[model samples]
Target chain A: MGITGLFLISFLMVHCFLNSLIFINDGGETFNLGAEFMAKNWVIRAMEIVLFGGLLWHIIQAAVLTRENKKARPVAYAASNPSANSKWYSRSMGLLGTILLIFLIIHLRHFWVVSRFTDEITSGKETLFNEMKEVFSQLWVVILYCLAMVSLGYHLLHGFKSAFQTLGWNHVKYNSMIEKIGVIISIVLPVLFAAMPIAIYMGLIK
Target chain B: MSGNMNLTLKVWRQKNKNAEGKLVNYQVKDISPDMSFLEMIDVLNEQLIVKGDEPIAFDHDCREGICGMCSLYINGRPHGPKDRITTCQLHMRSFEDGQTITIEPWRAASFPIVKDLVVDRSAFDRIIASGGYVSVNTGNAQDANSLPIGKEDADLSFAAAACIGCGACVAACKNASAMLFVSAKVSQLALLPQGQPERYLRVHNMVAKMDEEGFGNCTNTGACEAECPKGISLSNIARLNRDFFVAGIASDN
Candidate 1:
């Protein structure tokens, strides 16, 4: 679960970096070229396959683990409060992940699957960049993406450092530093990724 | 530092795990805020013993908060109202006069009740026995610099190792999961050079044992962090998932 989640985070960084080019004022041509390259590239397609597989594996594993956890404690205590021991995000990973998964489905349906199999939306569009902008033009789509990215950020905050610890990279001196890094990666990447679509739709960047 | 106060204590008293338990109310007067919560409890127990009562029995040792032996659910919070301090170190000053405090044991199936407020946390020991240590047998001690570990890795390992193995994570968990504890132990050793040899086997075995012990899976509530005396991070559980996944794949290969 950690490996898959971390891999997804790495993908987010790259995706965000690529998307950031949209803001470079090259008249959408550069963004269109990048999109076209990604669309045609075998390596990118292979990576997407891995990313999808990782997402599926991470979700499935979390579901199974959650089911097992419920079975482990069949009875609820009369007075039970969990805030005394753990972080809110640590305990809510499954819920947040589920939300993110729903967002992923919506995302793929509109962008990925739409771009690949359907020609209805792209009939009059000259470039993939135009289709991308059209998709983001809808306020609802942008809002949904923003919400999902926020959830993703929350999941990553807990997940980033967790992946390191599981691989046994925990050391007292470096643990705090690694945790801070995790926070930055989780928070910064997702926000940056979400910003591009909003910025493009809002005309902050042409 | 010395101020007298009146307080109402509602403590759970049970003869054994099988025996029924309920909150028994007792009024404590003249409590000094300077006294630790446990010391106040000691005063109450002394009064009970003098009155020929059995007195409240709770598990406590090394009141310094490192042993993870002191477990309490005070007024709906684990280890009392203090943040990042164990129940032993919690002082009375945190509470106001005429306040009502509730005390209970660490509630979990794995930790069966040996007596009032004292559950047999031997299940934790069993989990550790399953694979919490390194199999490397370096006779005596090796030089610290022998293994040129990065400062970052070393620091992370130490942080993971800070887990005191208290069942607070389990109790604080809505699902009663022990992932934080198990992961911290697994990650602390797994990250170190000495722990590499048995990393796969260790995680696989320990996680399997944790499952067998009836500990819940992590639901990611972050309550454990709020209640933890050591403030062990939930990221450790995430690390556990990664290691387990790797181990699962490796074993399959």
Candidate 2:
């Protein structure tokens, strides 16, 4: 879970950075160039396979772990005050991961399918940036993206530090540093991803 | 400092390990505010015994709280609402006069209920048997100054040693994980020079035993530390993880 989680986290960094190119405000020229490179580059295409593998593994591990954990206590507590001890998000990783999985399906359908399978971009009929603008044009799509980003933010907040601990990288001397880095990644990455759709919808990024 | 008052009690009653458990309500009158939580239960038990009723079966020993024998989940919190104390250490004063207090046994697949409020925590004993020990020779007592151990390591080991093998960490955990208990044992021994000869073997065998015992994995939720009666720190868990990983890679066996 930790290995795959950190793998996906790194993927998010690259994805967020590439998508943020739209803020160049050059009528999508820069963003489209980057998107075209990502789609056509053989190395990127190969890494995409590994990326999907990591994602699938992370999801499957989560499902298996959740099931095993549930089985560890067949009898539920009649009344448990879990919040008194731990953070809400720390205990809700499975729920947050499920939400992110649902969002991933929607997101892949919105952009990835069109870019990979369809000839719209390849035939010069449409560009990836124009697709983004068209997609964000709908208020509901924009709202869903924002909500998904919120879920992503909370998920990463716990996941980043948790992965370190699971891998035995945690120690008293460097724990604060690791946690600070986790906090930064959790906040910055999701905010950037969310900002893209909102920027397009509000005409801040044309 | 108030006078004794009446209170309602909802205690879990299970005839045996195979029998179904339920919360049976009973009213206790004029319970002293100064009494310990277990003492309150003793009052109810006396009432039940006098009336020809089966008394609640619970675990208790060394009421001053050193013994990990007492296990009770009171009012949704393990060891009651107070922090860093066993159920035996919780006084009636922490609760209200007319409150409805709920009592329960530790619930976990690894720690099955033997009766009403007594669970079979022998799983912990097995885990300890697997690796929680040193294989040093026991001759005449070695000089304490021979080791020349650092104070920080000694303090850390002492803190980890404070774990009483009580399953409160498991009861409070959402996953019913024994990581805190296992980690405490690992940390206590791994920090000492006498524990070095079998360090890798200890962590390796202990973790394997823990997994085999059907305890859940630790997700680092921090519940175990928060509810631990001895105030065991989460750093012990980190140490366990570190030693476990290094053992995986470094151990010849």
Candidate 3:
């Protein structure tokens, strides 16, 4: 889980940086070039397979772990005060992941499916940049993107440090630093990702 | 008398392991504020005995917090609402005059219910038996200064050893994972030179045994640390994971 999770984390950084080209605000010309490079570059094209594999591996591992965990306690506590001990998001990883899965499907339908299957972008009939403006132009899509980022933020907040702890990389001296960095990554990545849709919807990134 | 509590108790009553258990209500009046929670239960049991009813059967010994034998999930929190004390150490003064206290045994599949308020925690014993010890030649005691140890390592080992093998970590965990308990046992030994001979073997075997015993996987929820009566740190768990991974690669068998 930790290995795959770290892989996915790194993927998000790349994805975030690549997508941030929209902030160039040049009517998607720069963003389209970046997207074109991502599509035509053989290295990235190959990595897309590994990225999907990592995501599937993570989801499957979570499902199995959650199942075994549920089986450990057949009889639920009649009353439990879990809030006294752990954070709500820490305990709700499965739920947050489910939400992300739904969000991913919607996101893929909006862009990945269009670009890969429909040939709209490859045929020069449409550019990936215009696709973003068209997609984020809707209020509902922007709101949905924002909500998904919130979920991603909370998920990463617990996941980042949790992966380190699982890998046994903890130290008295470095633990606080890891935790602090986790908080920063959780906040910054989601905020940056969310800002894109909001920026586009508000006509700031045309 | 003015400060004494008259509280309602909803105690779980089960005849035996296979019998169905239910929360049966009983009233105990004029309980002294100084009485421990178990002592309060003793009062209630005494009342049941006078009335020719079956007294509540619960496991307890050494009434101090060290025994780890007193396993009660009181009012949702393990060992009651207190932060770092067992049920035996929990005084009745923590409650109000009319507060209704609900008590139940630890709920986990691996730890079966032996009777009311008593679950079989022998699973933990089995996990310990697997590899919680170091192999030493049966000979004269070694010189005390022969194996010089650093203070930080010694303190960390002592802190890890403070785990009383209470099942609160399992009960408090939403997943019923025994990671904290097993990790504490593993950490205590891994930090010392005395435990160096079988360090990799101990971790490898113990973790395998723990998985065989059907404890859940840890999700790093931090509930175990929060509810642990002995304040066992989660760092021990991190150590366990680290050692286990190393053992998987390094251990020959």
Highest TM-score against the true fold, candidate: 3
Runs of candidate 3 with Cα error greater than 4 angstroms are: B138-142
Q: lDDT score, residue A23, model 2?
A: 89
TM-score of chain A of each: 0.91, 0.98, 0.98
Question: How high is the lDDT of residue A177 in model 1?
Answer: 98
Local distance difference test, candidate 2: 0.91
Collision pairs in model 3: none
Residue-by-residue lDDT tens digits, candidate 3, B1-253:
7899999999999999999899999999999999999999999999999999999999899999999999899989999999988899999999999999889899988889988988999999999999999788524557546678899989999999999998999999999999999999999989988888899899988989888988899999999999999999999999999999989887886
For model 1, what is the C-alpha lDDT against the true structure?
0.81
Expressed as tens digits, the lDDT of each residue in B1-253 for candidate 2 is 3488789999999999999899999999888888998999999999999999999999999999999999988888899999999988998889887899888888899999999999999999999999999878734547656768899999999999999998999999999999999999999989988888899999999999998999998988889999999999988887888898899898886
Per-residue lDDT tens digits for candidate 3, residues A6-67, read 89999999999989988988888888989999999999999999999999999999999999
Q: What TM-scores do the predictions have?
A: 0.74, 0.97, 0.98
**What DockQ class does candidate 3 belong to?**
high
Q: Which candidate model has the greater lDDT, 1 or 2?
A: 2
